[model samples]
Target: MNRFILSVSFSLALGLASALLPLSSAEAAGPRCLTDCTPRVGIVSAFGAEADILLAETTGRREHRIHGRRFTTGQLRGNRVVIVLSGVSMVNASMVTQQLLDHFRVERLVMSGIAGGIDRADHVGDVTVPDRWAMPMEVYWHAGAGLPSPCGVAGDLACLGLRLAVGEDGRPLPPFVPDGTDVPAGSWHLRQNHVLSRRTAPQGAFFFDYPVDAEMLAVAQGIEPPLQRCGPRATRADGSIDEALCVRQVPRLRVGGRGVSGTAFLANARYRDYLHHVLQARSFEMETAALAHVALANDVPYIAFRSLSDLAGGESFDAEAGALFTSGLAEANEAAVTLSFLEAWRRRPRR
Candidate 1:
């Protein structure tokens, strides 16, 4: 028997393989496995809507299930590609990315999805291809505000919050002193990720920001995608388009800016403003940064297209954000950009 083949009883007796899901009797026979998982490009999305357009365009698709996630390999615009939905949130995204990398011989990765708009420059329905991505929630939240409020209110003291978890000299944060700890209400310092390094930053150094492959970014930036300023709303009785939801400015395909992601859904207007001003973040979403992190660590070239679905923090936490995100304009726009990039890249000279 081939070493690649496994019997479920034998595998369980030995123990589960690292980072791999439990295998069923069907998978043990190797029938469900793809004979060849190789593909030139691996396209990923957070959910089905984001990938609906690309999936429709893909040809000769063959699907294989791993850990219950579907990975479909096919020819996209005449280029070899594998596309999968990463589900949603940071952990799910990371797991799916690693699985795709491990199972498929993917040379490059492209992410297409909808994101909340943080910067005023990015209007609703605009497709943003940020040069870099980061996780803004990597912070040390304090028990309470350390600085006294100038306005003398508990919430007002947040205005006086400490902006840095690290010292001015660049040393790591000391143990929590609690009562005298200098931090804001949430202490959203947008602190450094003192783990893996990027570019010049050495390992174990502060590296919150992760830059996508330069060549991929250039190819992405060079193309113009058909973007929509208005999207249809299901709430309308006659199924007519909603004018208020339409972007005030002509929807643009913007390149070069910071994008931030988090595990939580961000909907507070004040927090959105802070992310834009403090981190200069243009796009906000749940999964892209985590996906980018895994790709960068693996040394695989990667890029993402995030369509702005709504003004961040514009919707009430439970109500509007969810509805706005499902609008087809943002989903279709990002998918369009991803398809365009793939076509352009297919014709480009070999690296």
Candidate 2:
């Protein structure tokens, strides 16, 4: 009887141990599930300061839970920041945005990144916080307008008469481009000095090419307080950089270094019009629109923060894309901006 009693006691102890082990493993594995939890904020970017910050931090795949859902399934900035890199085009932006929403369930989102200053008065490196973001209300495009159409064109065409119109109700109506717009036939050269002088063949059927910088705004709505500007391109074709890309100049205007030219256009009339209609932010970037679209659709608040790498209108910072060299201008400034952004979010007044 004693032996039988001891055996029973040992077996019960073993079972308890097994149950505790499984529970421990589960607890150690991933983020805790929280219902009606903390509000989450999102950060997005394409290139420049914000891009650098993301590249510096994230390992690509991560997950965290915030707010009522798991908005930040993968967190890079402690408990708050959920970072995403939206590849350079509108489609990429839109696709990733949806994925972020489904996975993280973000609440407030901020769209940020470097944008070409179309406003001549606006130099480079200046930041813009827009009250509104305009998007294509109509799905229409035109060719032969001497401007680069989204479906066609290589070089940076002028923003002659493209308009991003909204309805009286204040939502996007549709995206339309004036007739006779000359779309880039292929990928053209975009330099660092704010010069957009290349032309290329048409690639995608959807023509999204229209000036999205500062100048377009003045032409379209005549809003005062011209956009701010910043430094020029810093990365080289080989992805390496010399001292030329450094932000030696105050309120750096030209693209970094004497050798590389800036690829993006300055605030041309066309760019401003498109940005005002599509994005309508203080500044423009390659990634913001897509992030905004997704977050807004899901009723999530998103934010984007970027460091200025180049000025709006100037020479190419590097000779080619993906240049091997790094722009000193971009490297130095990005860190501070990123940190500040994080702290600011924590302090920002939440709705």
Say which candidate scores most in lDDT. Answer: 1
Candidate 2 residue 229 Cα shift, in angstroms, is 13
Model 1 per-residue lDDT tens digits across residues 134-211: 887876555544522345652232344323334445543332232323333344434555444244235333456779
- For each candidate, give its TM-score against the true structure: 0.72, 0.47
Computed on alpha carbons, the lDDT of every model, listed in order, comes to 0.72, 0.41
Give candidate 1's root-mean-square deviation (CA, Å): 10.3
Per-residue error (Å), model 1, residue 12: 28
lDDT of 2 by residue, 1-351 (tens): 999999999999999999999888865442232332344555555554445655456444344443232222234544355666555666766776665555553565655555554434333443443333433322224343333344344322334333323345743333334323434432221111111111221221122222222322222222122221222355456866444444333442221110111223343455445434443323444555455444444545443434343333334453311121243334334433544455444444455
Kindly provide the TM-score of model 2 when superposed on the true structure, using C-alpha atoms.
0.47
Residue 95 accuracy (lDDT) in model 2:
72
Q: Which ranges in model 2 have alpha carbons more than 4 Å from their true place?
A: 1-39, 48-78, 136-243, 248-282, 306-325, 331-335, 348-351
